[model samples]
Target: MNSDDPLSLTSKTSLGAYYESHHVIGKRLGQSFEEGQRGPLLKRWIGTGRRVLDLGGRDGQLTRHFVDGNHVTIGDIDAGAMRLAREALGVDTVEVNLNEALPFADASFDVIVMGEVLEHLPYPHLTLEQVRRVLAPGGQYLGSLPLAYHWKDRWDVFRGKKLWMARDPTHLQFMRYSDLRKLLSTYFEVVEIVPLKGGKKAVRWPDQFARVVAFHARKAAG
Candidate 1:
């Protein structure tokens, strides 16, 4: 919205369209979701769960880890990707946009997994609110996203470059640990924050040393 007037109606590529292009690229390159500690962490944290919602879970890449013990339902924006996910994983899929209200009742899910999806949202707060609303009391929210405040990112600023890690045109939010923690605190009680893929320094200072961070949070009991 920065490029346009404060009130003028403007147009941009739909989220589904943009992700559809990346989905095609990812498939062609034989790229699965980040094949590292992220999957194992999600599996262990969300163990033996049913009534799970994999938000924006395209093609069931990460969903495979925890889908065995749970009745997993995927909610995503792209139809083509949902088709692929169904074929690959046989999970129920819902076609919904995170930019708008989710089409689920209150307290609909026991666990919600949002892997690598938050940074792409234009209205992340609204989606967080929706997730909070759809979760049952004491339900858990597990999420992962790239953190943009590592030492390498700081180095880019010194070299007069954009503070972006990859060539993703859709990454609208580049958050540090504190930024995202503050946002998550508004809706849930944050229980854990695990930083991934950095040196030993990351264990002490995840906000500055880690490249990606995963968060575990729980809704307050009613």
Candidate 2:
């Protein structure tokens, strides 16, 4: 949908519901969450003092982990998601559309997180450019994306159904590791590309699928 379309607002509610349900389930599962597997990257990239911007951070499930007496702003296009985040985590939030330029001033954030958000946007390059603009020189950006040929896609293919990644109207793009690396290279220097370890059951065939694609990138110095 185009910018200013009412449907965009309505869709946010639907997306928020999906996110809340999944986040609640993930929290209950504890160790099953991807956060634990992503710890190394977070530890390496995030320092003790920094201001963070979490773009499309639904319910602030992951953002809360990084906000330890540091400035952290959770941003999403969905107001319901923002409300859920504030109520559950008591974090500050802002409503923003990722397809458009972000409202923050240049170099306003020391770090930016866009976990699992790249696939949903039609214009990821624009989002990355905005990300580069908002982050201070040498600032870090951390996030994950579902890689192509993941188990979920294979399961859907076996079942004669389209994968959610392919069929979801809101997911405008899918990327392989190489493609994502190439995209990020234009805006930031790639630091790490780590394959996420799934739950015990999914770990059997490691090469066949990964839970997510986690990466760290740093905005280039001027």
Candidate 3:
């Protein structure tokens, strides 16, 4: 892959178009539900006056929210997605391949948001380490990942159905709640972790019940 090629190491399919197409209608609908649930929770932490990096922010839907009083930058492997982010949200963009070191200086951002992105990386630990490095001291990292699912992933493991994420060619990792928290704790001080789309009762409920969980953690002093 040509290093300069925006499409290098990424699916040839237009990332922006994929988000807008019927194939992702379910995901779009889910975002609508999450808006009323997780969106507000994130706004309080990610809002005004911070330098934010929206990693894997396809098309800027989540990116636009943080742009109110913040400097938001989009980073993704797909050139088409970053273009959409620039054109639609008027934010800056950096083409990033998550498997490699991020192309930014240390402590470069105050907040790093990586919604629906952790699962897609081949080396999530290395990527998080980079995220920790770029994040300013006292900076927060907010992102979401799938919690183990009974019907989808767990069932596949038990009944031997094909892996759930394999359907999406880009997905390269799968995680459970404990695995995620343990990993985050290795680099950050986890402040909050909650289901992004549920009622108050969902707060204390087991993580396996929810399809996704959102996290907000501050960069460790290390």
Candidate 4:
């Protein structure tokens, strides 16, 4: 499959299946493991009483963490995913294609979570731009992305052999830390970059492979 063609219908279906299975496993493991990782970032938003937009919130697992007493809306391109999330987590949700502009009005949210979503977008920057437009000034944007070295560099080898990250076909982009940072800086003032643990190592040295990066950024007040 060509790397650029990530939005193929077949790919979307495959991703839907993968996400369904992944969430099942995550549920069995308990939500704490996932929610615990967000402690540092979540603490910053706690008690702020802000509205949140969770972009690409598959199955709403992550959205549940922040919706206890806050207004949260989950959005995703896949209706199946959104339905699953709504049914499983009992949260409000909208169907949206991230590559296209978001449907909300400007400054519509105080926080936007793009967790594990950008890599699937064909035009990640466009989504970020919409994110900036909808976020209130000083609103936080918290999320995570897969680093290039994550998961044993399977994609890299696939790329070397002329395969694309969108092998399942819904992933339009694959970004390393540097690339994502540079891209996000255009629309947001990055405040922090947190590395996640337990990823596979590509080399003996620690620097060789860093799998995931979580970031906290704020939309600039006009």
RMSD to the native, candidate 2?
5.8
lDDT of 2 at 88: 73
Give the C-alpha miss distance for residue 209 in model 1, angstroms. 1.2
lDDT for residue 15 in candidate 4, whole number 0-100? 46
**Index of the highest-lDDT prediction:** 1
- Report clashes for each candidate as comma-separated counts: 0, 0, 0, 1
The lDDT of each candidate is 0.83, 0.73, 0.74, 0.69
User: Which residue window of length 10 is worst by lDDT in model 1?
Assistant: 3-12
As a TM-score, model 1 comes out at 0.89
Model 1, position 116, has a per-residue lDDT of 88
Higher-scoring candidate on lDDT, 2 or 4: 2
User: Clashing residue pairs in candidate 1, if any?
Assistant: none
| lDDT, candidate 3, 100-213, per-residue tens | 899999999999998888887778889999999999998999988766553446777788776666655556777766778888999899998887644554566645555678
Task: Return the TM-score for each candidate structure.
Answer: 0.89, 0.76, 0.79, 0.73
Candidate 2 stretches greater than 4 Å from native = 1-33, 39-44, 150-159, 198-211
* Candidate ordering by TM-score (highest first): 1, 3, 2, 4
lDDT of 1 at 76: 88
